[model samples]
Target: MNIGVIKETKTDETRVALQPFQVKVLIANGHKIYVENNAGVLAGFPDDEYVVNGAEIKDKKYILDKCKLILKIKAPLDNEYNDYTKDHIIFTYLHFDENILPDKIRELIKSGFMGIAYEWVEESGRYPLLEPMSKLTGYLFAQKAVEFCTKYKGIICGKHEDYLKGANVLIIGLGTIGLSSLKFCMDNNLKISVLDKNLATVNIRINERFKTNKIDYIEKYSIELISFNNSDPLKTKAELEKTINKYDIILNCAVRRPDMPKDKLEYLIDRQMIQTMEPYSVICDTTACDNDLIETCVSSEEVDKIDIINDVVHYSCDHLPSIVGKSATELLTSQTFPFILEIANKGISEAVKSNKALYRGVVCYKNKITHRYIAEKKGFQFYKLSDLV
Candidate 1:
């Protein structure tokens, strides 16, 4: 099997999909790896490192033309669409739900190429590929909150450094991102109120994990639990408004609304909702893409900075993990390398057939949409990979 590692071309994207060590492992396993020159340089892996590890550093054309598996940190950019074909396998963070599916994705699907989206790859009902980045995002979420909150004099009234103490924080989800943010909040002595539809499930899971000593953060942080009817957003909004004004910062880590027409924006935190927040309050969205969570947050690409709308500060940068490039690359590679190995060893068709986790990650295969959510969203013909296999 021949694997290729390409440099990320997205703005501010510094992480590489495969590190030098991972490349070495593949080479030792009798798999040939072609790494683009300077692909890992941004992540602290020099060309010499890959050479020493027995990876061949090649030009972009050679890698895209020859490799069986194309590894990447982010989804391929629009210009790179021509590089893929039916014969190539793309394994990356294909965030279809992050926003409307681009024409490039449609093209790949139409071209009958295989795409394995890391975020959709689940094991035991948990997103294995997304977990590492989620944890990193949470850490960055806290940092961004602190930076913006202090700079704008949003949360703390007194000394900037002491603002975290007793500051009120509202976290919307109880998933990995929410949990990670809670940990950082606890460390800063912030008062936390968690709102989740599955409040009972969260309580039970946290208590069980804490009792079993499974999570250090749970044991350390004391949280106030708030339950709301997730299905009823208006009711939830009303219930939240009663206390939302008191929170200094609102961190939305919940799943985003499905992609819709660009003209019609469905927001989790809309303009009317932010009106309740105190002046200069911060809204940090870890699941940042469009205005799905933070209504005022112009696509970070459009504004290139925080937007002050309705007197509340909004930050929604999609690629948060890339800020810590080297660490993120290492974490990403460690978690995803096994799946890559499985596909390389068994081949795409056989790997999907044999590995349930890998099969769940397959978004598109052989011109068929295998992911139910994506298919439903895009109006594509749905066929379960399991059934097809």
Candidate 2:
């Protein structure tokens, strides 16, 4: 099997799918690995490292044309569509439901090349590939808040009592990213509040926290929970606006996929709601998707200027982990290498047919949508891979 790694062309993306160490592993398993020139450069892995690890450094054109399995950190950009063919098996974070994705990618998905999203691959009700990245993303949200707070207010973000004595943090959603953010605050003794749509989840997570050593010393008043659900967007928006003005830093961990209807999509912190936040407050969006929960969100590429929407700083970088490229690339490679191996060794059809986790990752195959979410959202005829296989 010939496996290829390509340099990510997405704006501000720095992580690479295959690390040099992983390249060596695949090569040792009798698979030929072709990496695009400088594919791992930005992620702190040089061309020499890959060459030393037995990877052939090839050009983008050759890899796309000849490789059987294509690995990428992001989905194919608009310009790369023509480079792909029906024979290619692309594995990456194909956020297909992202409203801002190029139209051609949608067309390509329906064209029958197998597309596997690392985030969508599930086993035993857990997203194995997405978990590591999600935890890192959540932890980094706290670091971003610190960076932006120092930039805007001349106040350094730190855990020491005197450094950021009055900084208040609000985290929306109690998922992986949200809990990680809470962990940061607890470790630093920062004043933090959490909001979740699931009240039962909030109760369970909070009760479990009492048994942990992380939040024991923090003042009970400093750490608070604001409970609400997705039953009513308008009500949630109103609720957010009411307390938004109190926080100095906001980390939105809410996740919204493309298949959701306009009304059903959770926009807890819309533009109107954001206007109520205090001036100079930062909103760090971990799930940086199009038409985000934070309506005024911008991608990392477009975040150069101070986007003062209603005087609040809107910072939404889709690939936050990429900013810390080395750690992210290593973690991503660790999680995804096994799946890549399965596809490389068994072939796409056989792997998906035998492995339920890999099958869950398949969004398209055989000129049809295999994933129910994408098929139903796009109003296309859905075909279960089990039936087709």
lDDT of each: 0.79, 0.78
- Worst 10-residue lDDT window for candidate 1 reads 155-164
Candidate 1 colliding pairs, count: 0
Q: What tens-digit string does per-residue lDDT give for candidate 2 at 1-389?
A: 99999998887678999988888888888999999999989889999999999999999999988898999988776677667778888999877656544355466665568888898899999898988888888888787786777788666555576544657888888788887887777666667887776754564565464455443333554567677655566676677788888888888887764543467755667787777777788887778765567777765643233466787877776777877888999998898999998888888889998999999998877677788876665566778887766
Which pairs clash in model 1?
A: none
lDDT score of model 1?
A: 0.79
- Candidate 2 yields a Cα-based lDDT of 0.78
Q: Pick the candidate with the highest lDDT.
A: 1
Report residue 361 deviation for candidate 2 (angstroms).
0.4
Residue 50, candidate 1: C-alpha displacement in angstroms: 0.6
